[model samples]
Target: MMFGQTPVTHVGVDPFNPPNPDVWPATMAPVQQILREGLDLGPVTVFVGENGSGKSTLVEGIAMAYGVNSEGGSTGAMHHSRTTESDLHSGLKLTRNPGSSKYGYFLRAETMHGFFTYLADNPSMGRPDSDYHGMSHGESFLELILNRFRGGGLWILDEPESALSFSGCLSLLSVLTQLVDGGDSQVILSTHSPMLASLPGADIYEVGPWGLRPNVWEDLELVRNWRSFMDAPQRFLKYI
Candidate 1:
């Protein structure tokens, strides 16, 4: 409803052509387990999970399904430095809203450096007056959001907190809130930061052994763990 275009309404495993057993091991859990029920998306959706919980994998799949390059950036900016993408995208199905997306970007924190390098090599992509390479990682990241992210688009971010300071995270939260509230945009994010996940009315989903399910911000493990540690670090340290 926020994005004039139907934001991606639902997402689920395609459930066709079962993957090869040898290539994709049974021991390695697939996102299909978590997405079997099909996930209904909100204007702002946040995926939270521990490392290797398939949050990044799922976000990349969604981005690919939406036609963004596997590495990052928009559809037109195709630069693949490596082939680390999972097969999930091919097996993923997306139900989009009626109208088409006018703008879209896949911002992967892990790959932003490589993407920026690609942009620098190809000046035709419209190089900013101040080179992104010259700026700090956090500064460049903020620059990208402030400049490149023209509202009225779909945005997918993976571990954006990696390059952000606590204050930077707050700034990003403010920027994202403005985007969703004022502009016609839908955002899906995979993060470990409770701060980022606490985006007012965002739909927070926890990915774990039980799979992805709606979760409350206060109930998040990240929040709980941080709160416990901050409340009494000495207690946790004493155990160690």
Candidate 2:
């Protein structure tokens, strides 16, 4: 079967030690309610929202629920973690087909470097040249995505555009679009980049004060505003 459509049949937190109650974004309550409704059947799914709107929190919750690592495999620089082991979220329920896999990869911003290092050391994945390996942050970002993401499995990426230049984001988009077209891999990404959100057939869900809701990247008011402002910065800047 194709990815994403394999309906998620259960949701739960680690019982021994759970996520912190304090770190749960005020927006999470509703988002959790909606996720409990149903999983998207589309090929590529995306979550977009403001910085603190709980997009990552919800994504991590989904990963934990599915038994995927919170870090998504690659480990590099450690950033401040919001959820402690003792933290917890309840009221989760299952609603679909059940299955399990041996491989699931979660990619976060800081882990990109580590991902590449592992790839370089492991020839089975792909062997990128030193120039590609040592390229700027954006180049390395593209290289890792191209090399590491080449199979049928569950992949979750949070804020992938952090290191990518606009062109690099476009490159990642091309790769993802092609991967989805192949009909084997499934990916859920949390990002704010319009370029990334605009991938064809991507189910874009916005998480914010109102919680998660079906959305179109082009319909986001912020996208339009940013496009307009960037189009004529001098025009908008004079007012400021």
Query: Judged by lDDT against the true structure, how good is candidate 1?
Result: 0.80
lDDT per model vs. reference: 0.80, 0.62
lDDT of 2 by residue, 1-240 (tens): 234433343444334544344454423654544543444445577888888777777666665555555554522322233444212233233333445333456777765565556555654436443444578888766666776677555567889889888888888888777666666556678887888888787778877776567877779755787899889999899998
| lDDT of candidate 1 at residue 216, scale 0 to 100 | 94
Q: Estimate each model's TM-score.
A: 0.90, 0.72
How many clashes (backbone atoms < 3 Å, residues ≥3 apart in a chain or on different chains) does model 2 have?
A: 5
- Model 1 C-alpha lDDT per residue in residues 1-240, reported as the tens digit of each score: 244554688887666754444554212454656344668887899999999877888888889888888887876777889898887677668887776564678898899889888777766446443478899999999888887676567789999999999999999998888888754688899999989999877899888766677889999988999999999999899987
RMSD of each: 2.4, 4.9
- Segments in model 2 whose C-alpha atoms lie over 4 Å from true places: 1-30, 35-41, 74-102, 114-133, 235-240
What 10-residue stretch in candidate 1 is worst by lDDT?
19-28
